[model samples]
Target chain A: MSCVTPSWSVAMKKNQLRVNEFGLIERFFRPLAVNNPGSASLQDDCATLSVKKGYQAIYSMDTMVEGIHFFKDDPADLIAKKLLRVNLSDLAASGGHPRGYLLALCLPHGFPLKWLENFSAGLQDDQTKFNVSLVGGDTTSSNGPITLSITAIGEIPKGRVIRRAGAMVGDDIFVSGCIGDAAIALKLFEEIGRAKTLKHYPSLYNRYILPEPRIGLGKLLAGTATACIDISDGLYADLNHICLASKVGAKIEMGAIPLSICATNIIEKNKDYWESVYGGGDDYELLFTANKDQRNVIENFASILNISISKVGCIQSGKGISILDQFGHVVPVRSFGWQHF
Target chain B: MSCVTPSWSVAMKKNQLRVNEFGLIERFFRPLAVNNPGSASLQDDCATLSVKKGYQAIYSMDTMVEGIHFFKDDPADLIAKKLLRVNLSDLAASGGHPRGYLLALCLPHGFPLKWLENFSAGLQDDQTKFNVSLVGGDTTSSNGPITLSITAIGEIPKGRVIRRAGAMVGDDIFVSGCIGDAAIALKLFEEIGRAKTLKHYPSLYNRYILPEPRIGLGKLLAGTATACIDISDGLYADLNHICLASKVGAKIEMGAIPLSICATNIIEKNKDYWESVYGGGDDYELLFTANKDQRNVIENFASILNISISKVGCIQSGKGISILDQFGHVVPVRSFGWQHF
Candidate 1:
């Protein structure tokens, strides 16, 4: 009889150090879900989700692929955190509080057990930090580099969810935290030979790798901000989204835009580099528009949250986005932000 | 001056026919989501989900990879339906009715636009058929084969969800519809040289590609069936899941195991083929256990749903499963369905 090796046997041969999918899940994923009664210890095919009374759930999913999203040699722990944080950022923009998330991992053959262990460790850390739990997910082998998808569920009080289309003319456009650190850091990483220069901006590099989702600020802005969005596809592109959705326009003042010390230092040396600082993506900062009358209230709220807020622009009656210098002349931008096709 | 190509330009170069991801979403995905108010016309990053009063949401996620799960040439429509159906099946097994789902697609570079169109059409068909809608999802490019992950949401009355561990000793083990068709069809396809034999089992082949989730039957069985699971990993393996979860054992009679005429003919040719029929995977039928006293009630419910219900065994107070032939002799099965490594 000709022996025919099963597909799974072939998989085992390639990764002798790898635990089977089920065992891996049982050891690493099940523990993260213990607090979630609906997860059923990851034993059942689906999990049950409970929503708080007078609350609606917010849902969002994002995918990260190796090489395209991050470097192959990046630490698994950071990857896990970045994946969850990005989705959490969505909730932040919508004024939702993190509740739980589902994860789907597609790993190439010979994927390491240690990688999964570290990834789960990262998730455990964030689950505690964000006060959310793992709901349910699936792990499978793929023929390509590692790809991950996270579906995050957050809760908002009934009819209280913030949206991107509520900005009105004359609304004050504000941004939380410093913008462009992630974009600059990403640029430094892409120019692999610029390792020497990257050492000068450690903070920017850290910001790119691990973004802090402004959940606190977002919750505070729910009833106050007229419109809101998290900065992922750069400030300009994302601002354009609010404009498109609200059928309005915006003019950002370059001088008033918040920048970290490191970003200021880089821009001072090469003023032309401002495009990358402003239009490069992955900031994860909250960009929102609020009634000008609420300026003082918003400022106090930002202080309470201990996050920097900048009134960089105003919503106008027209469409599209424009950037202005301190003298109020429109400055043409090279590109809007990172575009994934 | 050396002209440096922007990252987005590089992506555009690789997929000349592809539009930017945002525009692609607007054209293809947004239409399907328009009906769901919470989807926000796919404008905002996250979608809002409003659960009915006195109901808890059920969530499940599953991933399918090209080549690993389906052939490269598999019709996009079938692939899309399969992706949704598998997750829907999970909800059905959990006694939840489909409400909505979030999909994440990681398509290979140069993936066809027509394929995506067909895939969306399939989703539209199933959404109408099953009364579910697309709430939200993310789409991105991958360097490898296509990979898709779906997170399906369903709802059931608060505290009324079915589970796998509720079976009691002496409970009647039941399954919906005929078994082994998908597995047999998969085998026939794998041995491509025997394409002539596959023509004889058109029904089996169809079952393999498109599984009709017994949603109506599952809903009817919700509070009545003591324990339940969907039979994706063959009858024996899934039965073992219910057995393991309920801490019970079972004995299934080979003669009583329901099979279509095509499966019967194949098994008759080789009595050993019974292992494949009973131990093969991807059946997508519901394997449930109910109290023996509720047999008439379950039969009546099955009749109302117009689906076949077979009682193949009884739960015993033990720790494993056994297969017995018509003459009461234990049958030696080789394996327990498909085990993904």
Candidate 2:
């Protein structure tokens, strides 16, 4: 194959080439220099970082593809922020603080300049807010979906990083906030014409576009809770992740789930909305397990942290996740959870 | 669009899958337990890793795509090793010791099993060689290329991590090992059917498939070298990285460049082979700069490290890279170094 000459001048004319991934990276990240506490220089062929003595670094990676993770025209700015935020949420679930990130971007032909500008702006915004830097990344052209792969590096205070397998039988299960808003927002956005007939909930849309990562709550629960996971793959599936890792099962009470009034209203209006709550994805909330003895402590801590904490279920020595109805009997779920496979 | 019901088993197969944009990430990575260091009984909701005082952490990531980076049927085992080794080479370039890594894989439908087994065996080989572990990662199905994204975390003594911006004018430029063998090997590999006459150079082929990372040399140079970089995108482009980062220019003498006997033989047989050395990608060697006074020290150290070091160039005050022929006249390069863009 011949090496295609990318028209940087024409791309610049359209404002797409203002900051090729490398240019923006050089502008914002170059000044940080190397050797700051936890500093990974942007110039090295690679970054050098030290894991704390007696502590191992916690690492994770996620890739978001256009037309799969988000719509192709979903405001390039929002897409960039959401990409970083989702990875940050993963770090929060594991009780790891953002240290640095690596980005791999695959650009399709004729990538727009304004999109790159707005996308970089979004990246800069989140990086400033989160105090994370774009350390290094690769930029390549592809004939397929524009894919962004982010690997987030974080440090946990020695022995404080949470994992999925720490939950014990009988631990009280709690979720940090209302669930399913993102999925609801997705539906609403997909059917904007019908949104006028339904109640307008900008918060739901905001939840979908820019969900808050519960980094503080994660750090707060790091020392106290037994097991935790972020709700990226729907409640049931994410909760099952905790069970699988912790070697326990869970029984969640339907009535106890903290559904927002908007979610409740939506569900009442469309019976199928229950599927969104029970099986929808991309909520970015934290679900965790804690001992019953720590209930009062958790409540006080939650108040101090100013994040909602709701009891949704209890862990049991079993093999699968189950739900309870108002009658306190097992209710067969219509779906297990969202599966990427 | 419907949530496509992917055949999990078929998608997970190894050999049936061909390499494309997303490399062989999905077939190998399995979700594993998070072994947090701090909390005993590993019951904490989050892993709490205690950061040691006065020590900073280093992080880096790189993604290799099929066709864009490597070919599809390029020894599945070697492909796996190259993926990890290249990232480790990045860490080495920055003077960091490997700690662990997170992998994100995108696999096409109907991958094979034996391929995965061989790939994992290769990973096992490198894991033992480098003393690193697979920490965490994500796996998904894609309709595009097989892609592998690896984020490696490493540690350097506090304030000792190296950067490319520190090179001073007059600093001697040094590169480990003979350059261009990997590129020549690639060229020869591609012309295998027509160039049956050039089949004797197995060393060249090995260089292309498994370029050894100079980790120990990078570590040794960390304290002495003013700046460093890895030669992945050939010498010119990578040297430009150091120049741009350090705000300096460089002059390389063609005579000083170290060429392997296999590379020289190929060049003698085909004059065009010189282009491969100057413009080839995927040579995971380290290129660094140090003060002229340290030349003897570096020379002695190279012998001690058991690695060949060639003084190929010198840093100068200016803006770009230039090459000189034997008589000291400037020789125009035929191409800018290889670029993914």
Candidate 3:
């Protein structure tokens, strides 16, 4: 009864205007419209969205340029999934449920249509896994890198959503999933120059290529966590956002930080890579704060989500993040977050 | 008191992560969030949206690339407005009222910050004119041409939304405002190559730079018109979209198609430019259909809106379009829509 996004079936039928684009949508994206009724098979220029009675719509947009966000030689499917996941991570941090998204891609002139097949397939996989749908989007050609922008829309109960501005002093800080694996993958990628196989630690390569969004964990943290953010800009940098917003300080211990076996092994051999743990980003994990009373609930959340949830630090009375070592001595922070490509 | 976007004042205080980007938002974009409660001043990664009863949220996205959608040297402010207006035009076609929007900018590396001030000023002006607010978005640097993507959101009464599939045979095809001016400007741009002032017909140049979205007219037509669309691709191509969606044919006399004084003068000097009038795009006007009995009402809509509404053709029970010359012979079509960069 309500109109949302009419799918591409309307425009693609003509195939006389922007023939390649219509064809691309028809063959690749039209199938991804299964989640919502307003998709009308991508026939209309605009799609309609509606919110439920107790919920409000949540949105975030992230742009990823080839070579800046991912290597050009990466699998098209992984590239598409990573782009979607990063935006989803933001919504998760807000404790919203996955819903639908809009994607805009600017490709180099004469972009191969085959790449879209792989790209949309990646979207197909994630849309199924996350139980979301492709509501609307468009694509165009340029001389620039393959540029991707996705506006992710979700929903959260009006009363349950968390924010970055609610942390209180003495609140325990928790991070979901492992931290430095993706950052290490970036380093490995630069060293190997897009080798089809990473000569070692394929899990590190996998984590880099595909990130698992902490959507379930994030939703569980809602109402319980006082403040929350996603770890896209490295742990310290993203946590600093919490401190600045909540007008508090934080003390996170390096020993309490969760790490994958591969990451730990690499760090044991070379201390220089510690900077990656502290400053390198692309984690796509949830970072949040809750009072000491919520510690047991958070531990239960970790078990329920089947992902590691570490007590990295606690909110302090002052300002900024203090990165303490195993000996409780402050470790000099090397870097913060994304430096432009 | 419902938490929406917790503006950038929170994360921007640190100024250590993505410093250039945070500074850009603080200087230019933070000023444009005047229209919505959810726009927490561009600080948070995501914003929340709520829809009112009896309405459904309408959404559409448009992406523009330098050298593809517009010239690289075009004024940054005009470029920004056009990008926003184009997406707004899509929403207007669906009979949606202006609401809030998200923007994603992929700028060339070392993009001058001053250009952003001009660009944001353009958005500020239009956001005020349209009474919409900036909700959320992100920007990243790339080596590619300037790429801007906008997702415009609006609201339309559930029962009154117009769709392209609803037009029936015998419906009178109508277009709002003059059609050929922007197309003429495109051709003139090719001939002049970035001249500051047009030696002739500055109106055409102006139309190409900034398009007026018929948002108000679209809302008025929602319940009265059978179907509607905005002309972004030339009128012929866009009309063909309606025909394809509605499963109908169209017959329009070239002489009946409205043209601006400047466009008429150009066509008089050289008939070769007729193709530009017929197939050239970038005109953000509404084209719709109504049954014969509604002619008087359509005329009233025109007068009420203070814009000319011309009946160019009638929908027939078939497919495709027939463009008739002054002598009633069918004019052969050259192109229908956008080609790549």
Over A14-116, each residue of candidate 1 has an lDDT whose tens digit, in order, gives 4343566667788889989999998888778788877789899999899898877777767889989999999999999999999999999888766667788
Docking class of 3: acceptable
| Candidates' C-alpha lDDT | 0.84, 0.73, 0.80
Q: List per-model TM-scores for chain B.
A: 0.94, 0.87, 0.92
Top candidate when judged by TM-score against the true structure? 1
Per-residue lDDT over A1-341 for candidate 3, one digit per residue giving the tens place of the 0 to 100 score: 00111122224322222235666677778899856767656777788767777888889999888867777777999999998998898889989897899888777644656677789899999998998898888867666788899999888898677888899988999988889888877766665544633667688878777878889987888889999998887888888888887899999999998998889998898887788776777888888999999889998998887788899889989877899988889998867665442
DockQ of 1: 0.49
DockQ scores of the candidates = 0.49, 0.33, 0.36
**Local accuracy of candidate 2 as per-residue lDDT tens digits, B1-341:** 11233233233444465532113433343312223233222222222223346655566677777765667767788988888888888878888777667667765556565766777778777887887766666666666777777777666667777788889999999999999887777677666631352357777767767878788887787789998888887888788888988999999998898999878877888988887787776778889999999999999978998888999999999898889989999877876566543
Which parts of model 2 are misplaced by more than 4 Å?
Answer: A1-21, A27-41, A48-57, A185-203, B1-55, B188-201
lDDT of 2 by residue, A4-78 (tens): 233232344443445544564565444433333334345566654455565556656788866557767678888
Per-model TM-score, in order, reads 0.96, 0.87, 0.93
- For model 1, what is the alpha-carbon lDDT of residue A253? 94
Q: Model 1, B155-216: lDDT tens per residue?
A: 88888788988999999999889988888777666565335544777788678779998788
For DockQ, the strongest prediction is 1
Per-residue lDDT of model 3, residues B152-251, tens digit only: 8888888677888888999999999998788777776665544733656678878887999999899888889999999887788888888988888999
